[model samples]
Target chain A: MPVSVKNSQVVYDALKELGVGLISALPETWLVHLIRMADDDPDMILVRLAKEEEGVGVSMGAHLAGVKSAMLMQNHGFLASINGIVSGAQLFRIPLLMLISHRGHMGEADPWQTEGGMLTEHVLEALRIPFDHLDHPDTARHKIGEAQTLAHASDRPTALLLCRDLMWEAA
Target chain B: MRRLEALEAIYPRLSDCVVVTIMGAVAAELQSLGHRPGFFYLQHAMGLASSMGLGIALSRPDVPVVVLDGDGSLLMNLGGLTTMARYRPPNLTHLVFDNESLLSVGGFPTATSTGSDLAGVAAAAGIPYSVRVHELPTLTAEFDAALDADELRSIVAKTEAHYEPPAATSGFVTDLGLLENRFQFQRHLASL
Candidate 1:
């Protein structure tokens, strides 16, 4: 089938290895399988968010309860969640690990996503939320682990941009 | 009923649950009674207290989670009600204090002042238990029952749009900084 299915499993396994007991996400195209995986897992608590910003508060709650959690969303979702990221996570010093699908990048076909994709990194930079790219399946696990570790160690928000290179095969 | 009096009425019952309050008047008023490890004044995040309580409740189903929200904050995140209803964790209790205005920030009129019904929205959002209380006694009784119920609950408490300035200063400020409160709250959760 498609490589995204395998890569999604890799990402899901990495999250499990990191002891992510809860994951909050808003549905997105690239994240369908990841959200499905979280939903199917009996041991995982998957929270479906109405807005991506709510994930920040969810992660803060998880942190307060000493439970590891992650937020799965698209680049646009990240853009929508800036207020919570700054006011909630940053202000409260919560470790927020966000897995963002990098849509509208170099080969983006959807015109609607291009502007958000172009601005995603700059916004993350402006917010000072450290981020890394997951462009290859081979390195997905390692990168995810490193990001999670850094997030908790620094007690701040960090992000992983899941690139099209790993998540899709261009038609 | 007055907001502070309402908070005072319910403060005694909060010892067993983790209480998350919105920033501004709610947090300040709660702090005035005293600080506890279980109390997290979600400072600056105006509208996400319900979301935070949902996370805590989902993470620790053994512990009860209460969200003290305001009409202005709740209106800003109406989607939060739908999300909370979607999960409907048994241990989560959402208490919205509808003062009809943003009392902490200059008593600005909110949607509630113009005929918005928070309890109606919450009930329509599918929370199993949703009610509106206009008096302190009803609020206290409903709050106690909500904690005891084995289903998700939401209560919209209508209080006067009155602001009480502290004798010395604005109760809007907390003694502990944001980071310190977070650490202390986390430690307390860990202890339990």
Candidate 2:
């Protein structure tokens, strides 16, 4: 059987262990609970930027504030945020734990998401970012660790790709 | 024109400015130009360039922040324009590279060619200045013109988007533990 906890719970557990100091993101259905989980603790600073790009900037500021920061957003927002991702995050070696909503792939019924979905992998590749598909909850912690590690080691941006089952319930 | 020309033109011409762009071909090209960039997320979020730049720019009103974005990426966060428009950062200048495709991912068409007017939308949202640049000469000219505008300026350039694929990593960052240390050293201050 698959891991019984919600995808958000898995994320909260992973982040709780990692001790993510600060986080900024748009409220995502998949990661909302996880974000809240990370928030209850005083050490974790959770801020919602007006836009995904602002989240990236804030996470960088959070870095200044002396905390490991992360930004969680959707695939579409990820696309919109690439410039900052490339220029701001990667250039400055600002490591941000990017937890992205896996839309436009696998049972994707939305027509608008198809194009954005197809571009997701290649775009990450172009950024020279290594991404792991969270197909199973068993892989979630390790994947999150890997991304956070990269940010820590190289000061480069790392991504965590969480799909439907990993993040959401069957609606 | 590629993302390089845009950055080369913008970064060199201006001083004390914050420049941001997306990941992929453009990011590499900008790097090749010998400029130190800020947080470069992998090529996942697009429209966020300006949003991030805005955060930095707002905090440091003394400096100028320019967001070099692509059409598709700009489309990713449609609401960003409204925020930018509403906030109206006088030091913010957004230059979008309109390639009309997700060129970095696959040579697929973006909504830009079909039905999006990002500049128009920025204007509608209350950006003090907005225009479209179909060629470099015009873009360069516009960039020169907007420098003195003293308000939020949205300049859209119609350019061919190109990309050479990047190597794959199972995860983006190398060590999760380092983030704590990295954040500590810089303290988020690029200078001073």
What local lDDT does model 2 show for residue B125? 78
RMSD of 1: 1.3
In angstroms, the error of model 1 at B145 is: 0.8
RMSD in order of candidates: 1.3, 10.3
lDDT of 2 by residue, A9-103 (tens): 77777886897766676775566676677667666655655667767766764554345667788888899777777766776677778888878
What are the TM-scores, per candidate, against the unseen true structure?
0.97, 0.53
Evaluate model 1 with DockQ and give the value: 0.87
Cα misplacement distance, residue B104 of candidate 1 (Å): 1.8
Per-residue error (Å), model 1, residue B121: 0.3
Residue pairs with backbone atoms closer than 3 Å in model 1 (clashes)? none
Cα lDDT tens digits for candidate 2, B1-192: 765566667666643444656655665565455534343323444566666656555555565666777787778777777767765768778888888888766768988879788889888877888998877778888987776678889998887766543233222222212334334325434453
How does model 1 fare in lDDT?
A: 0.90
Winning candidate number (DockQ): 1
* Poorest stretch of ten by lDDT in candidate 1 chain A: A1-10
DockQ of 2: 0.14
Model 1: per-residue Cα lDDT over B1-192, one tens digit each: 998899888888886789999988777778887778899988887788999999999988999889999999999899999999999999999999998998877888998988999999999999888999998889999999999999899999998987675544346675668878889899988988
